[model samples]
Target: MSLEQSSIRDAAIKAPGRRSPAANAPSLESLVSTARALVPRLRERGQQTEIERRVSEETNQLFHRAGFFRLMQPARYGGYEYGFTALLDVISEIGRGCTSSAWACSLGTIHQWLLGLFPAQAQDDVWGKNPRAIMCGSYSPITAAEAVDGGYLIRGKWRFASNVDNSPWAVLGVQLPEENGAGFLLAPRCDWSIEDDWHVAGQAGTGSKTVVIDKPTFVPGHRKLTFAEAASGAPPGAAVNPNPLYSIPFLSAIPVCLVAPLLGTAQGAIDAFVELCENRVTRGGIGGAGARLGQFAHVQSRLADAAAAVDAARLVLDRDITDVELTAAQGRRVSVETRIRNRRGHAYAAKLSHSAVQALFSCVGGSSLALDQPVQRMWRDANAIAQHITLNWDAVSTMVGQHMLGLEPKGAY
Candidate 1:
């Protein structure tokens, strides 16, 4: 589809479930089932999404209809009040079909959950009346915010604001200069403007542009959430929401969003490779193509290994989410070791996903290299996701090793 046509369609597509007056929302299981059912249709639109350089309007509508956005939203504003597992599950399902759509949705949906860590007034302003309002963010300390009388004046630009085109709000990580020392802070979307700067080789549909805030506006005191406060497990919404899910460490849950889509993309590659192998015929050989492909013990072994890796990644993610929810339910803080393990598992999953795609690419032969081939797209998408800093294999492995050996670890956890 043409860019103009896609934009027009996006404008016409109304946002779904904008703070429904009715009470009692559907269960997270029901939401997951619905998302799973939509996978085939979403997969069918993969080419369109890649071509448009963003998720198609129809796919976005389907996700909205499934209440996918509310999986991590606050309950007071008509959200499911579900835990982290639901978010991971939804992203996994979507990623298995279209990596770009899955990537965009995962970033957008998780941003909503992270927004809850901000001040209560900021939460109310964004979701008090519109629970469906999506948000995008850049956690890197790339911007600056000045402390004014009632609020902070933010001025800076954040690159790779994923799903910015589809989101109405954003949170830019900033460094605020104080009399004693500099501190980290979060500034709302209203305080910034978006710059169209995303141009990449893969996951092009995410529309992860650069967000520019050249003295755009001011953020109220209530909306400013400090990085120190977040790390200490204290957020402005704690008094109002009072849900343990809100208390889990942010670093633990955020990386899952980055890795889950890659897992799904790997699954897509496996699926495509399997389908191609089934109908393929060997050229200039006595045996049929399928027979030849199947006859190679090495090929069979790699396929099994790839499948195992994908399943193992999915299992680790689900288990980690469950553990996080359980810790939250107990009203206890997650251990530093546990958090590191979660990151380790996610990074391991990313590595396995990359390995799976590489295996599939090797077995699928020269035909898989075509630009239009599904396997080729999945391969590119998986590799791209694996390159994410959050999924950096070496860093994560070193962190995990440190934790196992009782050494001090760096960064937020």
Candidate 2:
């Protein structure tokens, strides 16, 4: 028998039977409200969170108890089976508290959806024993691997694994030998180690560090998925989990996760700016004594503009989220055109969010620049998220333009 078949047989014997979510799965409204409630506490912990260079254990536990990680998890395993739009609502609200915390939550939550796209056996292997398990991933395929009898021997370092400190497993991208492309492997905690190299000026609490597989580790075949298979919009998981959400093209909506936190980050900046303007008084300037900052026409205009930009950003994101969900619901594949448009929307929304925060940051005085000030932290974290390659305006716009201009796009979809 093939090693892969043998591995499958072993897993089948150990894997538990499927089950459905509890009768009282969280409603979308309840999840959003729960996220909103986390804000005040998350706000209280924001500065110390960054200083600690990772989300505190208490915050993670709160998310666990609130069912945030199960937002996009499979219903068969007690996940709410909520879609991306639900993710948008909950994660953006969380961002209003702390960008780093929101980011950690975003990655943790979205990866559940991504994992649901994997084959059934793989999903069972990860979640069957621990329904609450959440994983971190590094999707770049720069690591090394060799095809073996059962699966492959993988060994290398993958970087930018967000929320790694809090996750017990990793989805590491690997380039299969002699293949034209790369794929992903599901590795447990025993297969890899974390490198504490996450020091940064922004989004520090995400703890996005490197994961090193110090030795050639044997990964079972059922736990592997190639990028080609994922992009095909007919991922193996679609058969086991008949939800259309799983059938949506990988790149079409997955990038949405990268920008979702920024939506809340910008809104959070807007909130802080409003609060700052309401009570801040101009002091000791030549002609500006005892003036309420909010009274100035120019300051008012900045606030209005920031609000409009952030509002527009949410509309754009929601539009695409709706489009993809509806398309998937109707049992149609997300077309290439829609995919490119969604890509543009993701990058554009990110641009709007970054610009909004930048405007508010410029208007806020030096006092806001202090390490603990919410607006400053929001600005820093927004800038950091905008730097993500998927959200880089120039790169995504150029790729979209190329597709529109009738040339094959050169970038990752």
- Native-referenced Cα lDDT, model 2: 0.85
TM-score, predicted candidate 1 vs. hidden true structure: 0.88
Best by the lDDT measure: 2
Cα lDDT of model 2 by residue, 1-413, tens digit: 45754554444222211112446576677878899988989998999999989987789989999998988888888887777777787889999999999888889998898898899999999999998999999999998678889888988899999989899889989887756689899999888999999999889989999999888889998898888888888899988888788888888888878888899999988888888988799883577779888887888888888888887787777777777777877778889999999999999999999999998888777788788789999988999999999899999999999999999998877
What's the CA RMSD of model 2 in angstroms? 9.5
Over 1-413, each residue of candidate 1 has an lDDT whose tens digit, in order, gives 45754543343221121112225667555766887787787777877777777776677667777887777777777776566666776788788788988988888777777777777778888887777788777778766677788877877778888877677787777776663333334455566677876667888777778888776467777776676666556666677667776787778767888888898888877777777767776573454444656567777888898998887776666666667666766777877778888888789888988899888887777777777787888887887888888888887788788777888875445
RMSD of 1: 8.9
Query: Which stretch of 10 consecutive residues in model 1 shows the poorest summed lDDT?
Result: 12-21
Candidates in order, TM-scores: namely: 0.88, 0.93
